[model samples]
Target chain A: MDRRKYLELFLNESREHLEGAGKQIEILISGGTGKNATLKEFYRNLHSLKGMCAAMEFRGLTELLHAMEELLEWGRAGNSSRLLKTVGTLETGLEEVGALLGLVENGDPDPSSRTGVLKNLRSRKKSRKIDHESRRPRNSGGPSEKPEVSFPSSIRVQMESLDRLLESTAEVVIHRLRLQRSLPPASGGPPGNHQENLRQSIDRLRAEVMEIRLVPFGSIAGRLRDAALDLAKRREKRIEMEILGTEISIDRSTLERLLDPLFHLIRNCVDHGIEPRQERLRAGKKSVGRLLLLVTRIGSELRVELRDDGRGIDPALLKDRAVEGGWLTPQAADRLGKEEILRLVTLPGVSTHREPDEVSGRGVGMDVVATRIRALGGTLDIDSWPGRGTAFRMQFPLTLAILDSLLVQGKSGTYVFPLHQIESIQEVPVGELERGRNRCLRWKGAPNVDLYSLDEILGVGENPHRKGTCPVLFLRTDGSRRGLLVGSILGRRDLVLRPLGSPLETMREFSGAAILDDGGIALLLNARTLLPETPGPH
Target chain B: MTKNVLIVDDTRFIRTMLRDLLQSSGRYRIAAEATNGREAVDQYKSVAPDLVLMDIVMPEMDGIQATVEILREDPSATIVMCSAMGQEALVVEAIHAGAKDFILKPFTEERILTVLRKVLIPQAASPKGSSN
Candidate 1:
């Protein structure tokens, strides 16, 4: 067998196992009590990883894992202090192994590298052993119970195969629709029954294929638990993390892309959101802080809410910071409401920490997290109460590849509006349309809905008004509600969205393009971009 | 008649390499491969190969426990321990659990063949193979 063919498989598997071991190590360091069962499990993972590195001829990595296994054995023997000291060394060694693996994947398998890590491990092991021998007379007792290990039954499948399966399913649905359209009006015939039956079966198959791409949220949440443990230990803070809805599933690619942003959020929670032990006690609260991550399915979106029970963001401080940083004039800052001021924390270079720390304040701002979540077609909202807590709510579409959209025709071209953003479709008489600085439509004693011409907003020229009545889509987001005018309503569709490339990607008004049944492209409108900034009074 | 062999290790790359080496020798037939010791024990009962090549440390159950279980079921099962450097203690433990012979990893093809001959082709094998 060619070794090169297995290089990618080797790299991916190695990285996963290494991450698992690193997480376990983090738990152990954060006062895990070095339970014999946990130590044994950690040792086994390291041992297996060492064998893999050896098979791949990565001598440096194999040596590092070997040392880690030894240190784990000492930890198993009830040497907590010595084990704590070795955790930093092990972490640095793990990082080196990751870098060396990257180099090996690029056709440069340098086995002699990481000599410094090997020497560090060797010296640490010798010194620790000497200390162990000197203190051996006082050691006593061994673990009485061993934990049983169970592995989940799973196999790796290439992502391309999954995408191809979904694409073919979509193609089948498209062809089936075309066939159904071509059929003549059925006069109570068996052919029509067969066509309907075929359509139903095709729909079921498409749904099953879509479910294949769904991965449970636990896959990433497990890693986040480890990260939180590490950060809490480094900051010397006591935090209890409660993760709910790990059973809920999200698109695998979406979960993978969310890892970095979620990591930043968790780190921020530990570093900034949670008050220290002394501060909490002084405030008549429990010494240990609480951080909660809750995932709930809301219609077609997954709403992830992260809440921390600590000193919340002070809106006054945020306003001051905004003014001091010249992000807003003092008068402008004073005019902003508390909720708006709280949102300034997401601005670039806006950090509340008085001094930079090793864990969370490395100069990277929270704006990166907000921008990334937006790029995934999601929205982030912050809610904070002065002395109560802060909660961040992020809602994302279940999958980026397919969406339920309402198709509407404009003056220049047809467009797609995500169905989740539309509250209702109503026809208002053209004579009742009210215009001032912004168009408005008032109906049935309801509040005035800010209206905009979809054609005008899309730079497709002014829309020619219908003679008697006009159709408008009632758009409702969490913060505001508005209306969009279209030439004609063309019903709903399940669209397979393809991202715009190059020059077209610069268009902020459109999110992506979808292919219509007639083989024409329909640009999908971004509802958030079209909504008015402020809600009108009722 | 070719000897049927079961290879057990947690790493896929190592399993593939061993399968290639053993099949190319023409004297051994690859029966199956298992990633962990639990799977190794289950595969042993199903395949019932003439020889088993087992790694010392694995997730779920180590090779020693797997060897003990298999030998309890069939005392005559031929098993060889595959260990890494600096695991002499584990090699001895595995031997006590009824492994027939042992070979250190990163071993050369000649060394592997010699160990196999010592364990399988006992009468034709030279006494020099028993040095370990």
Candidate 2:
């Protein structure tokens, strides 16, 4: 076999099968012997997985699966008691196989140390079979047969092809927009009817093509559940995980990128967020802690909120830790509000855990999660009540390809702000600007909105076209509202986002670049970065 | 005459290996390739290949079941069941389901060609002398 040519396919298929079986094992462990149908499905998955491993010549994984299949066959033959006892052993064997598969994926195919596991499985199977035969002399037969399941309807497609299709559709939309701009305006009536119709049709086509890149949250939910189960088991804690809005679909790339961060957060919740059984009892809470992951789509953004009902983070402690670590001075730490203090946990290397453990406290803390979310053009908010619970609400764009932006002309150039971040735009008189050390503007309704001129923030000197009245954009960052002053509002546009590569990416002021309708590029502003640090006591 | 062959396996690696091996021999042309047994049967009907190399354990339907289904439609359809070491029972069942011959996986190029020649050119070829 030309293993290099199909190694990715083999690894992907193996991972899928193993995940399916692992999920079934979790379900069987929790639900017990009543889930006979699940057991059968689990058997089939393991059997197919064994075949793939054999074809790959992964002897350890093959032997492990074969032993598991034999044990499952015994269980299916009405020896549920024996199977129940060996479920832990089977899970351990499955993990070993997973480890071996990981090694193979990493270019090491040595299966030399599997003899101990194989011997353990073979001896257990022999002893169990003999025990069953002796107990029931007449009724000792092999597993009863079950009917085969029908084929699944869906087939896997390469992600590269889906991306190519998305790119072509985006190109078509861009061209259509360019074509519309080139046409002359209508004299009187309701504009060009044919052009409007063509635009609508192209919009629908673009939507359909984008939908092809979406995958439901349920695809990764099983793995999350498995992780929760494993962590709860290892820690001797009882955790009930509730997943909501699993039917919501996210872009495939976003889903893949989010998995690791989600894993880290869930592990943190199980390890640190949830209190131990006795601790929970002392706190007048139930013995089984609850961890909830809720996903919802609001317009073009997907909000994933993971909440754990456990001992919440103490903001005061976070502040003290920040001061001790020199990340913030004692005076500055004291001035922070409760929410601002809680946000301090996301600072690098600032773990609240007093001692580092194997699971979460090796210095890679919530800061990494925040960084990952920011990289995906998203925001993360931490809300916790010291005695109640902690909730990390993450908001991400539905897809990274295109964004709805409000284009504004700045002194440097045209800039686009993500429409979701903008609260409102208003004309503030120049005299109302409170310029005592830090710029501030009192809009009629939002009195505390700190204002900064776009030119000053971009270090582009001053806007030559500044007039008596300033157009201030009210924006929301974290929980606070701020104002951004620009030259003029150029209206809203759906722009395809292109990443600024190389030296330009080092500039945190701009998120990315987008091409306008007139064929000029506008830099998209990162509102979070633009939000001035709570103007220190001046 | 160039022979048409259908390769069936759930794993793309195995199917690709078979296709490359057969194509490199210059004796066979891949008529179709299927990931599962149902697709194998459907492609067999459409392509009517001279031979089939089928993997026994697959989703939707196994090779044995597909062999039975294909043999029922055309009794003389030539199928070589692909088996791994632990699937002796399944290999036996596949043969009974009308598979012409069987080949073990992780097979060498020589072993595969020997099996193919035994089934496809039985009168003119001997297993030991059919290398080239």
Candidate 3:
């Protein structure tokens, strides 16, 4: 690979390292014990990051991680003397790395200088030496010495190489499926059996490869907590962070993509949702504000919520802002539900703050946050009361690897509905279908969302009635409940999802495509793509 | 040579930068640097420097215990405890244990030189009684 490619890989890996550091800092701040194993793992991670950064000749990142590694190792040795200061420096260093990454992304890479801070710290360290001796009474337990860290050679593979290998494996599997179908079923019996066996083995191998791609959600939660803590400190608000369901994991790439949006949400909580100490006191709330990050696994979905008990969003003010931003009319705002009103803050270019702070307000908006959440096959929901604070809930696909999809028959092909999004499927009789306005069904006493046949949405010109298949899969997208109409229901199974090529990406209905065991392309439905707009009364 | 001072800190960059700045002071020099408490104690015995700049909290043997050891070895030894914020208690403990003085971390030239002159000057005024 070219130097540019190497730089790209460095950027990606550096991001992961920063994220890990951010999370570890959160763990430390939350009063979680720096367990020996965790510390050793963190130390090794920093050491590896430093080594790779040095090899890549990204001196700034290398130097920063080297400093952080020293701090963490000291931490491992149970040094609390200047741990907080070191943590602060590490936070700033991570920010600098972010800035450098941005520069690299924009084709202007400057590693910048750490000389100023480094010099200051060095002087402090050296000056302490004279004092270290004078204070020692001379007879003590002596010095503690430990063996050096040694790494096994087997773990030396670069992340990009791992990624490339997975991608190539996916390609080969796809091609193999194509070849198996092309062979005559009876004529190629022996060879067909061999291909079938190869397919099963490849499927198993793909599952393992996917496991390597996962990064535990605990890390993402930790980083968000750190960002929240920093903001709380800056604003002089006393807030505590606690994370639940930390052991639940997500793919590394998805977790990385989540950092920015999570940071923005926490910023909103600190800058907007959280009030000053006096304000909070007068509101009959405790002086110390509480922000809770709750992560829970709900079946196939992972939900991360940021809940703050500060001053909440005012519905009236939200209405005013929505109207001012041209997102709502006066009459329309009156009839909006509380949930609906709460979502106005998430509108593109809309902010509730009368004066935005430098940290929270930038050119890009929460629309980007929503879009990012959507891109990961996730949905974001906001709930708030007038004085009870706000909570932003982001629900993501449990994993980005192989999805268990409910394959539904479309006229041209099978559309794979991510099983996570499917609430339930029912065979609604044709007579039971409410034909007054759109394709809704009156099922089990509740009026479920109207379902649209994939043929209708894809404009495939397949008449659902002509096909004589009536299976409706209820779906929850963007906080609204809806249903998708499909020709037939194919039972759930695991599929190795593959990204669509550039040419096919314009079709937004499906997020990606995956190969089936019997050799066929099943389109993975983008559940968020088909959210239903609130209907007007007839 | 240049009034050798042994530096003990966990940060390498900090150690190197300190070495550079103190060398520029024209009155003091860094004899050796150790990244943690254990190495710091070893380096101190070997260098037998004129002064010591000790970080209060370090791996293995902290500045308090380190200060206790050095003072026991040579009561005449001049040691200054270096502390960061939230280390007030530790600094007091280190002082009680026999540290001559202390300087907070991320110190500027003024702070560094002032603390050094206060702790390193052998003939300087005693901190008003209590000598071991």
Candidate 4:
């Protein structure tokens, strides 16, 4: 019931929804009328995200996205050039929301950061401008009558309820914790009495509080499907977007935050994945391109898989690009695996288009999508078969509010790693660690990895242990693998994740902070951040 | 024979460029120049110029209003409206306001001459009683 935790979730989710709307609208603009349905979908999605943000009591995000949704709605109803310009406005709004979201996720979100976009949207007043200028009379009547762009009766919600609920829940949690601690220890009572009852009730209450943050997946997926239709039409290609698992429940904030990556993957599939009708016909396939988006749950994680049946990736082409970009030599490129080729497509500024075109395949967008996904502690995988099709799979947690972490003791203090990122922990004998330039450990039958000291990493050292068996946590980041050295492993448990303020947030290694049962702040270290920065090809 | 020309525009850079271009030819001499349409009408009356190059979107009365006023003073006077791509409809309306022709911007020397030659020569060469 921590307010900061809820706020972090809300900010993150709102960002995702805003990004999704931007990507969809941009595609609709580039693809033209064939993307009309997608344009409407984008407008509706913005409205929906706004509604959800309002329900979550994120007033700033709600206000911003609401105004943005109105603008998009006005744009969707207009013709080609108008829609393109409107989408540009949408991008500006999205950028403002993105900057604000970064602030909120780090705590201390600046509400005034987005006044310019809001002011611009309000003053633009598409309907009034169109009506007044178009219908102004030359003779007796003074000015032209403009068509009034009206906001629909819906999209508004009561924020007071969410605020009240947050306050009451926080009070109840504090009270319950106080009462539990006050209970007498080791009293000659049955094991399943008052304490067990209290624990059961607390668990149920915590579950209910978490459930309040869950948003329906359908709202996010609806806009992506619409965008695919619009993009396909514009490209003169047939793309069918089939959404699976639309009713799944994810933290409303997570659903919103996940939109940019999800929408990009869908747009990429339609724009770059599917070939034109003539190409499809020449390839001896149906004219209609098939794009499937399957959002399914795998244990505690949700997998958003977007698969397309068009022209798949050519490893040879990717290899050529890598060699051309000097990322690798011809010999090294030939030795590269299939997955490596797919990874190249996600590299910043690497587009598949030999010549830049307004439409997709000019790959500047996917890098942003990859970064957003990574920021949310998600992993994106690309699988492609030449002449077949390409499928992008992104797996992420359903909740950012709560994280299961492995708390570890270091020289400085106790630090936590999200359990998913910890590949394995091994008690390596001190003798096995060969001292080198920067704590490199060479284990039998394993690659040599750099040893990262938790205290050294956090910049707070109190001598964790000079001589003892050190526990090594192996982590994988973007394909680069590394090991972290912690003084002691403290098992795993679920903790309510809270964002750290800007002062301490400069520490990129730590994602955020969480409060332990003893009321001490634990640093939640992002495993990927722990990896040493690899030097780019010179 | 040298013809008198009136130049109307908001930007000093553009007015200077047009004045230099027209005067450099030695066949045309600048009658007067105005920054806005309101001033343009006053200049047009003072000079009674043979031709006028007018900008459409200027402060203190647009070119269309000045064109109407200039035509009201003398129906024989020729005024060409300067416009950009986004202001095509406004250019059409300016033509209906009794302007003779339009020159698009950012101006090239060739385009300016073509529009100017068409607007000035055709009307000047026509029989005095012929209806346009």
Candidate 5:
């Protein structure tokens, strides 16, 4: 259906309904009927308007109506006494919505999302809660109401059906990809045109399904900001936390997974990255440190950069620490590039902090940041300029449900490798792989690196690959590359990965199963297991 | 024969939207329309449609009340409550009131047809599977 065709109808009916709601509120406020049904009507009027606005994608209007609906609920069951206090705020909210509707009618930019109407509504709710608290003793009525946490509550309407539809859509898309890859192009016929049209239609459907799965970044922005502010206050650090791209949306699961990683990153920024006011003045930087979380959508990926303008990491010190920590040899540390030196801080043993503090150093480690980001099919790059600032640039996939993976033929069978972790795939003669007397292998990229054999590590097959040139896949681990010798490099494809469950999950080698286009399942090799941590050959 | 559907809502826009959606599908026909719960129950008793499209909150009488009233008269009635955002609690109450199923609004054409057909077509085709 053309939703736009009903724009006029929707606006007209919404106006009439909202007008009726305004009067209904008056009757309730003035205690005209003093009946429950009057309040019910008033709530319904706003509720219906909210639904209409939501469907029309009028975000600001929907939020206002939603707030109004919740405020009206305060009067419903146990909280009827608070109605008189809320009526004034409700009137003001309605007036603001009226102005917002006029803007919609005039084709002006939506002011609803940017306005403070919802903020005022929330503040009022808080005050009322306080008022209620003082009047009634503590823990009196057995948990009456949940405090509104300055954010919209998520309601997954028809979550099951939506998920089923997405799965079913993936099946169709995979089928299409397989068909097109196998079949030759049809020349000059309606069949070709039909195929093209179907492709376009399917692509559009996939995009729409993915879009619905996305929630605005603003949904989690509140929590991140709150955490940053709370940490800064405790640390006695004067800092301004600015979050950009609050309106940008991402998959719900991605947002959930990212919350902790972001929290830790923000914690790091506030506690360690931002310098004290005195230190900042001495360094010729602003006293009030700036911690910025900037998010932008680049293609099908999201670039979330957490930057703090403070005392940056000195690469020389980090290099020295790496040597002292035995994570790297002094020579290896000296060979590291500018970017490579900054990365040593993310290593488990190396720490930029001379002393781990109460705020950030306990349960979660900095090493977990890179691992978590990588697990979500993302990459984390640490960049810092000494005495300037440090920025953690993390790029996360829009949807990890479908992963771009490399299909490699192992001795055991075909295995899937996450493309994000894999660096360059090289085909080199076996002669090129030379093990030194000290047991370190020398490759072209590094004078000495750790070499792992797929056949031996995975116990894939009875026979090992010998003789001729071998294809090697180099994976970026921490700041170094680990070379893996595989049987052969098969092709690459976008795969839908399902987590291994039950007895299969017990296996440490494979993280999940990536469903191939041919309806075959290939076990995804877990990089963490494939390359177990060991003291590096300096 | 197409199944008869009774559309109930206080808003004219919503009613018209449901009607258009149902008519366009060609498998269902609007038996009647009612603005509120009082009219909804009365219309159900008279027209006796194969299904009901009920809006949860209305002026005179609510959809939950109408659902209870209709189910009391004919326990075999097929009623699907039409819910909107923030009406989750009421939707649950309607379900307890014996609503067979529910469709959320603002309505998409596909969503409406899928929900109505899900409730109506199954009973029409296989009476034995209608155990619930």
Candidate 6:
């Protein structure tokens, strides 16, 4: 194989590492906190670059990266002040790497011949270390804050997705050619099968494309764990993070947008919520703090419960902070209940931390977290017990473009409910229904659940189930279960849920409109909107 | 029939080199190429290739983790670990993870073929015309 052929691939992949490290260096120079995490990322990139350059036998690149790594590792071990002083040298070293790569790119078979850059870096590193050895070191940062992470965080357009698209295209082409023929279609012949093949192919293509847009939570779990471990190490706190439902995958865009907010939450817990090891032990708790990122699907929504067993936020502190920050008067702060006061964390400029530091708990990012979640069409709720812990539960709308929905007949016409939310469809006799203002329902060998008419909720038309019976669709939300009465259970469909634009979007009862096969449209009901929080009959 | 092979490496250079070496021998077919271990596992499951040439220290689940995952799913899977010099420790870990044989980076055509042949057909890599 030609070495130059490898050069392009080598350059593309290796440049990514170099660029990633260079970006971290820029952040460090800009006085970014999480300096430990930044340096860890820097070292990781260099280590990766070393491995690659070594394989390619690019001695100059290897030597430069190796020297840079030694200096970075030393600086990460509690000499950030020294690192601050060497930013120029580090920047020059990075530029030297770029220059070396440029030489390789220009077909220099022996880029190793130019060893001037490596020598300069080594000489400078020696002098800097000797100059810094006399001064007492400050905080001895953890060896490596972020442990080596090994999981693909982003979804790639791989052969599988491409293959599916190709197969679907081939199917459509074959069907088109078949339709072009004048011969009548054969009932069971391979030569002239129905358009079902095209339909099946199209459906498969839609599904494959959606899957491409969704990434398994486990993909990003590696970094989340890394961040948690990094913070725990830097803070010198013992924390165990358990991430459940790794199998649950969400929209790629939503996942990407969430990384920062999730990081902020983790930082908040570590900085403010979690007590140190000795503090935890003194509080009669386990020496190590426990954190859980539990994701579960409730009805049609995804609920992510982030819970940490640590020193939970004290509402009194929040009250004081709210008053001191002038966001709320002392009387107004006192008027808030425990839950309301805790929610003040999501209010801008309301932080209970004694002092603000890097990462979070400066009363800045929590509000941003809330705003971001809201922008994603999600809700955030926090509750904490001072000595116990804090639990934050975020609910996200099922924003997948393709929604599996259950179509039901109503007096207004037909509507669709997200199939995942519908627990069971039961035909309830009129006598079985405790009808009136507050309708209640009972089913054979099932727990009694409150039932309301779909018409009453939508006010689209008169009730169609006043006579004989109705099909009650059971739904389970977070901490509650209820059933809604519809004309009847029509069927199920894989709906291409199109968001209602502008004027109609204001109607929160319907999230998106599902265009039916026969020029008909079914409003995909938002289950959250329909649950009007009537006191639970249970 | 040419043995189906899946080349796994983030560095396209290594992947391309391995592909050329394996295909030039005319004994292996390139079933797929994955840039990382997660993709490797996915490709392995989907393509079910006869052999895998895996590189360690790549991003998002390195060869050792990918090897463990693949072997766990299919105990009989045949995987060949690839490492640069000074990654012998990683190679040992990969071997313990059930990779059959190993190859070094800056690959020599003969070396890769020998390792692939040995792993693919233990008795085939004989003193005679086995490599061919």
How would you encode candidate 4's per-residue C-alpha lDDT over A1-538 as one tens digit per residue?
A: 1234345445555666666777785676577554856765675456545544443445666667766766666666787676677677677777767776676666654343423455455444533322222222122211122224332212332344543554465555555555655666635333324465456566667678667666678877768878889877887877777889998888766777788777777777887778888999999988899988888986667888889897998878877776777777899877666776787887766666676556554767777777666555566778998778998988777776667688888866778888877678887766566544443445552445556666666667522555767788887654566777788998775666666655555454766777775677788887755554541221
Rank by DockQ, highest first: 5, 1, 2, 6, 3, 4
Q: Residue A345 CA error for candidate 6 (Å)?
A: 6.0
TM-score of 4: 0.46
lDDT, residue A165, candidate 6: 59
lDDT of 3 by residue, B1-132 (tens): 246788876544345545666888888767888766677778778878777888764546667788888777768677877655345787888878877677764355677787687555442344622221
Q: Candidate 5: lDDT of B15?
A: 82
Interface RMSD of each: 2.4, 2.5, 12.0, 22.7, 2.0, 2.8
lDDT of candidate 2 over A277-347, digit per residue (tens): 99999999999999999999987789999999988997777788888888989999887887688888888
Model 3 lDDT tens row, A1-538: 1235456555666667667766775665555785454455455445545544544455555555555555454544556645555555555555555675676678764364333332222222332322221131122111121112221112234567667877786676667656766777734333554665477668878878877776677877767888888889999988887878788777677778788898888888888888999999999999888888887877767788989997888888878988988987899999888878877877877766778678888324677777667666677788887788888898877666567677778788887888878778877666555542543334442364555666766777543754334777778665567776777887776667866755565444656788886777887888766543553232
Worst 10 residues of 2 chain A by lDDT: A144-153
Complex DockQ per candidate: 0.26, 0.25, 0.01, 0.01, 0.32, 0.24
* First chain TM-score for all predictions: 0.63, 0.64, 0.62, 0.55, 0.54, 0.51
DockQ agreement of candidate 4 with the native complex? 0.01
lDDT of 3 at B45: 82
Error of 4 at A498 (Å): 3.9
Q: Kindly list the per-residue Cα lDDT of model 1 for residues A1-538, writing each as its tens digit.
A: 3456667877888887778777876777676765566666666767767777766666666766777677556555656666666665566566656777778777776443333444444444442322221122112212211112221113345677788888887777667756766879655434665575476667768778879899999888878988887788888999889899999999888888788888888888888888889998998989888989999988788889899998888888777777777899998988787667877887877766678776677336577787667656777788987667889888878887777789999988888989998998888777666554544435542346677777776667654584687888888777577888889999888778877765665454666788877778998887875555565444
State how far residue A521 of model 5 sits from its true place (Å).
18
Poorest 10 consecutive residues by lDDT, candidate 5 chain B? B123-132
DockQ of 2: 0.25
Model 4 misplaced stretches (Cα beyond 4 Å) = A1-200, A319-337, A355-361, A411-413, A420-467, A472-485, A490-493, A499-512, A515-523, A526-538, B1-132
lDDT of 6 by residue, A273-377 (tens): 899999999999999888899988765577888899998998888889888988889888876777678878877888887677866757998988876665554
Name the candidate that leads on DockQ.
Answer: 5
Candidate 5 clashing pairs?
A412-A460
TM-score of every candidate = 0.52, 0.53, 0.51, 0.46, 0.48, 0.44
Compare candidates 3 and 5 on TM-score and give the better one.
3
Runs of candidate 3 with Cα error greater than 4 angstroms are A1-149, A152-156, A185-192, A362-364, A406-414, A423-427, A436-439, A443-463, A466-469, A476-482, A487-524, A533-538, B1-132
TM-score of 1: 0.52
